[model samples]
Target: MDDKIILAEESLKRNGFQVKIFNNSEEAKKSLLESITTDESVAFGGSMTLSQLEIYDDFKNRGNEIYWHWKGEDRKKELAEAYKSKVYITSTNALTLDGKLVNMDGVANRVSSMFYGHERVYIIVGKNKISKDYDDARERIKNIAAPKNAKRLNINTPCKFTGKCNDCDSPDRICNVEVIIHRNPTGANINIYLIDEDLGY
Candidate 1:
């Protein structure tokens, strides 16, 4: 792997996150399963990376309560009252080599839940998601992840046409709330798994 990835991983660790670097997604899947079986409750954030992993099924098969943003039209109401419990399978968009967890969301379910909902949260990231710094990471998600994701969802965002970030506040802004996880909370409640392979938007 590259030095940037190593540096980023080390920085993440220093911030109090339990960091695990995997060689590939297959390895990541195996490890995530182990964690899920041992944990009492497992929750999922809105992560394209985790969605693409398609590994949450394993957690469900094990009789674990897998939580995620409700897709129902009444999700806002339901999620507002959902149990704030330990999450064992949440993924995050890695922002920088300086070790920030930067992310954008529409409903704020994914981002808000990260703060206090789950007693324990697991963050999975791919090496390709790493950037040099906060600005670079933001730029990447704006110019790359956001546009591509909008196109993928057919959201009709400005990025779908401009092919880059104009930082527009259009109603279709896909890059709304952003979060930079500067440090993991006290105790090893948050675990991070970094795969060498590329994953996520």
Candidate 2:
């Protein structure tokens, strides 16, 4: 493992989060499959990392009850179902080496699900998401992740065109809510899987 991965793993574990470091997405996916049972109910936030791993398809193929608003027919119903799921899987926008998880959300569901209504929360992140510290993590989200996401989603935000956050007040601004997870939420078992590969925005 790289020094950054080691530091992140140690810090996250010390901060009360279960941490796993994988050399690649395939190894991470294998471990993920082994961690959850076939009957477990799984939910997902909008995560390009999860999509890259095709985790949803794997879970669905295994007959696990999975809810993802992005893939569901009824967004409202799926969102409600996801809230009630046993496991919630998502990705963070930035992960600090000091054990902080940072994310910016538009609807707030992804951030909300991380802290409540789930027995276990699995956060999948790529090496590209790691930062030197909390402030660096925030900057990574604001200057890199958020801007790229806005352009990808075709949102009319200044960051989309400028490739940087202007702290815009646009209604379509995706960086509406900023969340920092310093420790595992009360009553939730948070597991973080750090993949060596760059898999998400």
Candidate 3:
């Protein structure tokens, strides 16, 4: 286990987040599937980590009501249903050592759901996404997370081509909204699952 990840877990726990450390994504996936009940509807945000976990398919096959925009053509309808689901699972762009979750979004749905409209929100974080502090977290999001996601989605944004944040004025900008969660949202149980692997951008 990396020292940084351990430190982050301590800090996040101090800040009132339920922190769990895993050796790898496979272990994390096993635990997630076992813990997240079929009785409660589950929702997922746009996350490479969750995609890699193949949780949507696993849950769908298990007869759990699932909602994710990436699953079908009805993105708007799916997004609405996702927000209303009992359990919300997603990932943060960056997790600071001092206990902060930093994220940037285009559609704003994922970011909003992080702090609202869910009985429980599970944040799956890979070791690569950890940072020293707030500034470092946001920096990585712009240069690393945002750019990679833009390229993956084939968006016509400068970051996608430049492999860095150009801070372009394009209407298709992925970082249209940003949020920094200093603590868990009111009336929501937030779980932070920290895996020691480079799972997502």
What stretches of model 2 exceed 4 Å from their correct place?
none
lDDT of 3: 0.91
Order the candidates by lDDT, highest first.
3, 2, 1
Which residue pairs in model 2 clash with each other? none
**Ranking under TM-score, best-scoring first?**
3, 2, 1
Weakest 10 consecutive residues, lDDT, candidate 1? 69-78
Q: Compared with the true structure, what per-residue lDDT tens digits does model 1 show for residues 1-201?
A: 766678988998888777888888888889878765545766676677887788767776778665555332565544654445466465665557877888888766777676565666778888888888888888888888888878887876789888898888778887778877788855537778888888887
Global Cα RMSD, each model: 2.4, 1.0, 0.9
Candidate 3 local lDDT, 28-80, one digit each (tens)? 98988888888989999999999888778889998998999999679889998
Assess every candidate by TM-score. 0.87, 0.97, 0.97
CA lDDT, candidate 1, residue 182: 82
For candidate 1, give the lDDT of residue 4: 69
On the 0 to 100 scale, the lDDT of residue 73 in model 3 is 79
CA lDDT of every candidate? 0.74, 0.91, 0.91
